[model samples]
Target: MLVKSLNVLILIVLLPFFVKAQTCGITNIALGKPVTVSAEQQYHVGADAVDGNVSSGWFAPGDNNYIYVDLGQSYNICKIKIIWQTDGRGKDYKAQVSTDATNWTDIFSRTNNNASTDSFTVNGTGRYVRILIATRVNNWASIEMSELEIYNSLAGNTRPSVSMTLPANNASFFSGANIKLTALANDPNGSISKVEFYQGLEKLGEVLQAPYTFTWANVQAGTYSLRAKAYDNQNADSLSLPVTIIVNPSTRWSLLGNQGTNPDSVFLGTTDNKRLVFKTNNAERMTILSDGFVGIGTSTKPNAETKFAVNGAVYAKKLKITQTGWADYVFNDDYRLPALSEVEKYIKSHKHLPGVPTTAEVEKNGTDVGEIQALLLKKIEELTLYIIEQNKKIEEQQRKISELENKEVNRN
Candidate 1:
C-alpha cells in the first residue's frame, strides 16, 4: 500500500511536465499550403516541406536558406516540428511568425543542433510561418528538410473558392486588345475580401467588391496563363484554375476607317511565299501569287508569261490600247506597196492576207488587237491608192476619144 501511494504521487508530479513537452492534440495547419522558398533544387520544390510526406523534401544549396508557408489565415500557433533528411540537417535555425508576410517575429531558435528531427512549443499568432536555416550541420554547404509541421490551437476555417468566368480556356485575341477578366468567388463561412487577377505570376489588377472584374489593357502578343485568387474576410485565400489564352499579331486592315497608317508599310498580301486567295460564298474567286501573277475564275496556276489571266470572257464599256507606232506611215512617199498580183499569189499560198495571222495561229496564240487593227488600216490605204491610179488611166482614155471624134467631124 505504501509503494502504490508513492508511485501515484510521483506520476501526478510529472503529468504537467509531460503534457507541456508534447503538442496538446492540435492539428497541423500548414499541410498542403502555399510554400515559398529562397532557393530550391530542380526536383525538390518548396511545396515538399508542407506536403505531409517525409520521403520527398526540399533541397537548397548554400547556407542561410529559408522557406515559409501561408496557413491561409491567422492562427494561434502552439508548436512546430521539422524532419530533416538523412544527409542534410540545420546546425543553427530559427522559427518566425508573420501576419502580412513582410515583417517577422522570432518565436523559437536553436544553435549547434545535431538532431535529425526537432519539435518544440512556441507562443505566437500569425498567418505565415517561416523557417530559416542559418547554417548546415557538419559545416556542409547544403540543407534539406522533408517535412515542416505547424500546429494551431484553433478550429479550422473554410477557405474561399474562386473561378475565372470570362475569357474561356484556349481563347484567342488580337494583340493590343483589352482582356476583360471576370471571376466568381464565394466563401461558405465568411464574406469575401478581395479577388486578384493574374497573368502567370504577374498580378494584373484586383477587385474588392462583388462582381469581381478587371480589364487588362493593351496586352502584347503571346501565350499566357491567367488565374484569379480570392481572399476571405479571415485572409484565407484560394486560387482558381488557370485559363490559357493566345494573343495573335494584328497586322490586318479593318472594314472601318484606319488612322496613322503608312501606305508603303501597309499591304494586302501574304508575308510568306504563298498565294493570297479571295473567296466568295465559300468558293475561291481569285488568287494573287507571290510573284505578282493574278488568276480570276481559275484554279489552275496562271500562265508564267502573263501578268493577269481570266478563264472566262471579259466585257468592258471601253477599251484602250497604247501602241508605239501607227499605220499612218503607210502613206509615206518612200513606201513601196505590194502589187495586187503579188498579194493575190501570197494569199493563195498562205490562205491568209500578208502581215495577218492565220486562223490556226489566232486559235493557238491570241492576237494583239492593236497590231491587227494597224495592219487592216494599212491594207485599206493601199487599196485606195490602187483605185486612184485606175481612175486616172480611164480619164485619159476618154479625153483621147473625144479629141478623135472632133477631128472626124471637121473633115466631114
Candidate 2:
C-alpha cells in the first residue's frame, strides 16, 4: 500500500511533463518505480536499425532491427509510424503488438528498401511497440523522428465491456466443489489487464487473465452473489452483475493451493493423468487428501514435502532418495522422462524399462507355475530406426520404378 501510494504520487507530480512530450494526440506514460516498463537488451538477429536510446539492456540492436516502444496503454489503435534518425542502409520494418508484454503478436509489418519513410497500423493492448529491421544492409540510413500519427477515431471510444461464461448464469455449487469462472473483456480504446472477484463489496481474490476458476471446500451454506469485475492495466474496470450460487453444507471435499504459499495461486493440481485433491488445514498448506487422488507435483513423494506450482505447473523441489537422505532441487513431474542411466540400469536389472532383457528376466523369474509369462515382448523403440530405413528404401524403389517405366514407354 505504501509503495503504491508513492508511485501514484510520483505519477501525479510528473504527469503534466510526460503527457506533453508528444506534440499532438500523444500520451506519455509516467511509469514510476512500482510499475516496470522495460525488458532486457537483446542483441543477435537485427541490431543496425534499432534505436538504443530508451533502454540499452533488453532491446539490443539485432542484425535487421533498431528498437521498439510500448505505448503503455491499449487503445483501438489504428495507424502508427516511426520517425527515426535516417540510417542510409535501408531495411525492412515490422509492426507488432502484445497483451502481456512477453508474447508479441505481429499484426502488420513490411519489408522496404526506401530510406525516406515507412509506416504501419495494428490493433492490440500492452506497453510495447517495436519496429523490426527485416533485412540488414551493409550501410545504414539514419532518419530523424518527427511525429507518430494516430487515426482520430480510436482515441475517444474507451469503454469497458465484459461477458461471462461458466456455471450457466444461475447454478448451485455444493460446499467443497470446484467452481470455474470465465469472462471475456474488451476496452473500446484499451485492453483488460486483470479481473477482480468480489462477494458483495468484499474482495475475494484476483485473476490476472481470462477463463478464471475458483474452487474450495464450500463452508458457508447460503445463496451468494458471485461478482466479477475486470480492470485495465491502468486499473480501469467494468463490473458485472452478480451471479447466484447455492453453497451446500453436505459436500466433503474442498480446495487447496500448492504449498499454500501465495494467495493468487492456481488451485488445480495435476496427479498422474488425473487432477490432484486436497483438504484444507488451519495453517499448513491445504492438507493432501487421503485416497482420492494425489498431491501437487510430487511424482515420487507427496506424503512428504511441499511443491511449488508456477502458472499451472507443479514442481517437486526436493528429491528424497532414502528415508532421510534427499536432494533439494526442482523437478517437473509431468516431464519426468527417465534419464539414460535410469533406463539402462532398470533395463538390465529390473523390469522397469522396455527392452529384450526385461522379457528374458520375466521368463526367468516367472511366478506362475503352469506357463511362462513372457511369450516375448516387442518394444516400440526398437522399430524406430528400422522404420526410417524402410521408408527410405521404399522411396528409392518407387523412384527407380518410375524411371524404368518411363524408359520402357520411350522404347515402345
Identify the candidate with maximal lDDT: 1
TM-score, predicted candidate 2 vs. hidden true structure: 0.27
**RMSD in Å for candidate 1, one decimal?**
21.0
Most TM-score-accurate candidate: 1
Instruction: Score candidate 1 by TM-score against the native.
Output: 0.38
Tens-digit lDDT track of model 2 for 1-412: 9999999999999987665231123332312212222122334212222332322122223354434554456544555654443443335656666666677767666665554445554565455554455554444333223223332112333447765565555687554455776666777656677877776787777777655544433335567777778876445578887777776553332344122222233334544554344435643333234344233433233223324322234457864432221111112234233455666787677755543345565566433212222212123333443466579999999999999999999999
Model 2 has how many clashing residue pairs? 47
Estimate, for each residue in 190-290, the C-alpha lDDT of model 1 and write its tens digit: 78999999998999999999999999997777899999999987677999999999987666556664333344655567789989999999999998888
Off by over 4 Å in 2: 1-154, 216-219, 251-412
Error of 1 at 244 (Å): 32
TM-score of every model? 0.38, 0.27
On the 0 to 100 scale, the lDDT of residue 59 in model 1 is 92
Lowest summed lDDT window (length 10), candidate 2: 323-332
* CA lDDT of every candidate: 0.87, 0.49
